[model samples]
Target: MGWIAVLVMVSVAIALIAFRVLRRKGRDDGDHGASSVDFSANLALAVYLLVLAYAAVLCRDGLSVSEADVQAEAESLTEMYWSVAPIPEAMPVRSQIRQYTAQSIDLDWPLMAGREMSPIPGQTLADMRATVLGLRPVGEESKNLQQDTLDRISEVSHARIVRSDDASTGLESTFVILMIISGLLVIALPWTLGVRPTRSSIIADLVRVGVVVIGVCFIILISHPFSGLGAVEPDAFKAAQRQYDQIDGRFPAQP
Candidate 1:
């Protein structure tokens, strides 16, 4: 992005200027504390890169779990819809399933950017389960069917709760601060290497600072599960809706 390029350029410029000022002020005492600075900077860079890798993994795991939860929820809805196709009286139940999915995709999905979901869709799912519980089936097969539908609804309810929790899953603020500190130390401490600031040395320092910026930016960009371009979408729910239509067209619920 343009913003990213601008930030990297600005950061490199500021770092270079700061170090050049230090050099002009005769701050570099030939190898006076070079070993200590070298050790500290190396340690800081190691910690920074390690934490960056961990944050990347955390973001990846959160997105993967959220995606799996969504697919499971959609699967439960499709299975529930199929289970109730034989009973004409369960028309309302089927309709409620569709309603819940629609509300989730349309209303709740948008709210996920803020790590939230509307209660309306969840309530609709609960009501569907209650309606199934109220059914008085005569035959053993009918009783089994009712139980199956209830189980499917329960699965959907569980998956929805998990998905909501997953929405809030991301890197913690404290961890981000730690990353920033370590990254800056890596950029700043290397100036104590006690070497004269030639053009090539300054350029090498600039490259090091640039790498730090890129790493930090990557972590920040991917730190959230529900926001950003790599966000988990409702594609699973959309596929479930398509499957519902296919099932309905084939079974053709009779009156």
Candidate 2:
């Protein structure tokens, strides 16, 4: 599931808990000192807010790093495709590389971004290897083309492997858990300190709810750094595909 949904759910759960706590306190006949309760509640809210802010910052940084890594891998693949395109005999292999690279960006990328593993791993790898093998005959005629193709193939292979590994790391789970914990803490802070039922207290509750709602919206808005969840961003994937296309275009012109 997306982080937005998780955030909303957590917010709702916290709100419900807060409501129950308020109901219980309203019914209590004991003379609890309002001043002491207010002081404690405010203090707890401050601490919770501080911790939530820190966690959000940390998660944001982690997501940014992950995105950068994915982009780098895409660029690397593009460069690899272009590097060996100057060889005439490797044209067919170059075409295959282009096709695979396009598939990676157009198809595999969305799946990876959504935290799904590739369904046809064996076939994908086989296709990549086939492209590498196709360059073998041409490599015999030109040592430079052969060496270049070999190097490009290695780069593409390594990038693909790293991408696959990154997709499986389950970063989304960490995000979901953090959001849930933050929501719970937000709600529990007010309850544990026994917030009064004054007009000011009601305003504070409204403000807290508003904060949670805003946080949920922010998470949803930023979920799409390039392309949201399922949709493909052609421009985002362009760097990788361009390299593949350049190889395809150049192979025929060489030798």
Clash pairs of candidate 2?
none
Model 1 per-residue lDDT tens digits across residues 70-157: 8889999999998887666788888899899999999898998887889999889889989999888777887888899998988998
Off by over 4 Å in 1: 1-20, 23-30, 192-198
Show model 2 residue runs off by greater than 4 Å: 1-31, 119-122, 134-141, 170-182, 188-199, 216-236, 243-255
| Reference-based lDDT, residue 104, model 2 | 68
List TM-score per model, in order.
0.85, 0.70
Candidate achieving the largest TM-score:
1
- What is candidate 2's CA lDDT for residue 33? 64
CA error at residue 3 for candidate 2, angstroms: 7.1
> Lowest summed-lDDT stretch of 10 residues in model 2?
224-233
TM-score: model 1 vs. ground truth: 0.85
